[model samples]
Target: MQSRREFLQSCLATPLLLNNFRYSDEKIITVLGEVTTSQLGPALIHEHILVDFIGADKISSNRWEHSQVISKVLPYLTEIKNRGIKTLVECTPAYIGRDVLLLEKISKQSGIHIITNTGYYGASDNKYLPPWAFRETPVQLARRWISESVNGIEGSKIRPGFIKIGVNPGPLSPMHQKLVKAAALTHLETGLTICSHTGPAIPAFEQIELLEKEGVHPGAFVWVHANSSDTNNFIKAAKMGAWISLDGISDDSLLKNAEIIHLLKTENLLNKVLISHDAGWYKPGEENGGEFRGFTTISDKLLPLLKTKGFTNADLDQLMLKNPVQMLSVRVRKT
Candidate 1:
């Protein structure tokens, strides 16, 4: 009998299995409108424009002005645009300061394709979840998300490009499971990719398993914040056709992130990986948005480190360009 690693390798080698993870002709939804994958160019799969840590009941768009946020955050978007980043996925979910109008304004001013999401964030002990999230069934929650995808978010014509949900970092709690199921239902109807803010392998795999049980293929899910999980777990999850998002790239983690990417390349799993700084945002209620981090580390720091580690231009493209386009392109990936 084949060992687990051997079985995974064989499965990845299968043409049909691999094709399921490739980019399709489908267009990705942007804050402005739909764009082809080729138009996506070099992309950051995970990042934020604004985030409010206040509990859901208290969070409101009234706390921050769109003009002030655009003034504070547009320079960072321009910085990445200068570095050849054409697209940015704003992963901040609803009830935590996800203003689609704000994202649309930033995208228009900066000339960068910004993609926003639809869903609830259940991480941080469910503090970001609205009160109704606890009372609503998965189907009910999914209807809300689907409505946004079809009719546009918050009464505007700006539709979500993906489904962004969050779960705590342990085994799936009942509430978190409901969030995952709702995401699944939304994806089935809207074909939006699910980007869950999951750290560590336990919850990541649990979410993946839950997605599979819902008849959503693993390719439909992105294991966000996957840098927190073991490298071995990355191999396992990548073999299952999930996108491994090592999105917390920073100056402090240059070497470690480079090594991890190198290992994934060696395992022939680099195509399944997504990289970003997980940086940015104008924090609500903080003076001057508090110490905002620019989204330049991957372009300025990590890419240089990766090149020193013998990464080719094509390898870099696979991580920054191809992988993201394939992973984020709109498709209903069902098993």
Candidate 2:
């Protein structure tokens, strides 16, 4: 229930650590339904723990599915935990197979701080559906998102810890803008953070501005999919206040890999950046992004690259953990 500033101030009370700020036991705080101790471990800001499709008459993946899913996702999430990853923000929302119960189950099974999302994605994602397909007044939609994010989704125990918005691959549509405003209002009301599904395009920054129209704070919003964006654009976004999620680390493109590495070194925006694979994209009966690709990127690639680049232990911790914890505190909750 603490505000964003309160969380950051509390975290800063602890002395800075060699690798990052060491969480002091005395300053730990509980959030949403989970407890965040000052133990200070690695955190992934953008990734999907569960992703299934919903429909007009379909219930989609729900808690009942948790029993089945845990057996599958537990192994992958466990590997992340094994790599010393302690916390992860699940950016999936209502439309993108955002199942709170399933995420909670994953957290319980994996013993990681799994932060789930609330609110709907961009209209392009669900504009095809009727009823919801028809556009409603901003207030009406905002009310629904606020309720879903704060309260449970349809009386379920899965409350969203953040509000999520998105920008299509091109310019922001009027629908995306409306959704952004609603997302921002939902966050202002609930103190939850806002995460977005921005592509490797320019709209992420534009989306941030639209959210700004509602006075959304930049620190609390994380613009995703920047790992493939233009180099300077990535830095520009970091300068704007929202955390830049370099989450597409799995694409296996050496040019992108090298570009990201260079940006990490030159920008020195480690505290405002994040890393994730955005994996586990299980579309109803489809496995587009799921796999047992060991934590090669986090465990082997990035760290080794950092060491080779002469990033001190402190620098590694900042890029790996501290920066994320700091950004997590910037946005108030959407739920």
Candidate 3:
């Protein structure tokens, strides 16, 4: 077996072969359009540029000032960029304040690669989901996502970089199963990764089963917020070849994340680990961006702590750089 350091070095030498095949022709979609994997350095996999489920259906009398949002979030984005974060994946799906225009503006001005997603967040009680989504079958939902991935979202030229879906805790809900199926279909079509926001191991495993049933690779699935889950469960998911995203990185979860990383290293599963703050929320029509958090904790704080906990520079680089490129890159089918 190749050591982690040796694997990372080989990948760095010839990145196109990192996926075990050639992906030099592939490009990762961003808010401003497509960019190559080499261009996506030090990414925050799960963060939100704008999220407002409170006023989903109502357009009028809403507090969404474009200029205010831009002005308030620019400084925060700048801080993230200064912290050496080049790519920021905005996980705010449609109907939940997924303002692509706002994200494009932020990306352009901030000069950070901002990648948005395409999918229905069905984790909640069908509130964020549109009426049409509930009535549509899994195939219909998959078609919509396929169109968004191939063409553009909402008639715009900007396309989504990946599929972002969600499910409630415990057993799989009907809608949740459909969402997972749709995500799997989208992955099969577009080769984009599916980032699922799951509460616990049960839903995560169910999603894995559904994706496997759809013939999607286990690596195509990302278990978002895996930090909130139990250690054994996360390790189980990681062993199955899924990307375990510990995205809720913050000052509060510093030591906790360090411990988890230590465990993954011990299990020799560090290659599948991903880390991010899951921070950044720009509420429209809000004063001062509504309790916004900077995206510097991972690079600034958590990394140094992890190093002290015996995680070497190679391990951290694999988590932040190589792992992200592998996850975000579209997986080509073996012919």
Candidate 4:
């Protein structure tokens, strides 16, 4: 088995092959040509581009609505750029209104790296509207995602940086199994990292264990929102070799709070952790709270608190910069 260091390095390395395959006679570059994080200049590990519906099937509109551009969201991103923010990861799953064009706008406007996902959401949040539940087998799912990584989503050139999954707070359901099987398949194909959303209770190691069994290398997968759990569980996941996302927040979800930043630094988990407000660019309720529900604390709060706590440039660099880059550099494979 490849060690975490080796795995990350493999994922991060960019290879240039297919010299004969060209766009307009220029050699085409595959996902293996560049690590997602490598293509990303500066990035927040998580963010929402444009989310219309949680359940894709419920929407009476077109499937492509999810793929529509982020042109309307450019102005909201202006503040983030003004605050020196750049790059983002959109965790929206298929059919659930994951808008790439909106992200494109944010990318161009804020000059940020916007990395998106290629897997399913939590069991309760199946926005894919697959017309039926659990349609594809694990092997088949893996093959398709691998095809996307190389050829791009839907045969376009828009590749995803990671494979996202979620262990919702409830017991394992059949739908969950399908997702797990699919994720394992994705791991087999693209070797992209798995970013999981742990539910309200901070799921048990069993879920993580199941993933490892399904072929997801621990080093390549992450359990986002693990900070909601106590220190013991947080450290447990760390020891198990999964990266822990530490954007821990109160109900308010204020950004980079002084207390949380201090807690992270004190525990020495900085190197293995990532930080973000999971900021929502949209107004909650279609313009009231700005689209995102409870993460109000992210926008103007987190970074300033870190600074107030005397987190110097180097400190921020490690938490927000070096750590994620280092982690990505590990499982990264480039052709």
lDDT of 1: 0.88
Q: Which ten residues in a row have the lowest lDDT in candidate 2?
A: 23-32
Best by TM-score: 1
Candidate 4: misplaced stretches above 4 Å? 1-41, 60-71, 125-129, 200-204, 248-251, 254-258, 281-300, 307-310, 327-335
Worst 10 residues of 3 by lDDT: 14-23
| Per-residue lDDT of 97 in model 2 | 68
Query: lDDT by residue for model 1 over 128-179, one digit each (tens)?
Result: 8888999999999999999999999989999999999999989999999999
Q: List candidate 3 stretches off by more than 4 Å.
A: 1-25, 59-63, 332-335
lDDT of each residue in 1-335, candidate 2, tens digit only: 98755644443333233432655332211123634545536777677666554542354554235566677677777777766778777777665566666676677767888776666666355542325624776667778877765566767756666667666778877777777777777778776767777876568878777777677767767877776577778777777777877777763753465457557567767677777766665455545334534333655455545555565667667766777666554245321
Best by lDDT: 1
lDDT of 3 by residue, 253-323 (tens): 89998899889989999889988888888765566657888788887677767766776666777777778
Q: Model 4, 129-180: lDDT tens per residue?
A: 3644467666666676678777777545677777877666766666776676
Q: What's model 2's lDDT at 118? A: 62
TM-scores for candidates 1 onward, in order: 0.92, 0.81, 0.90, 0.74
Taking every candidate in turn, the Cα RMSD to the unseen true structure, in Å, is: 8.3, 8.3, 5.9, 10.4
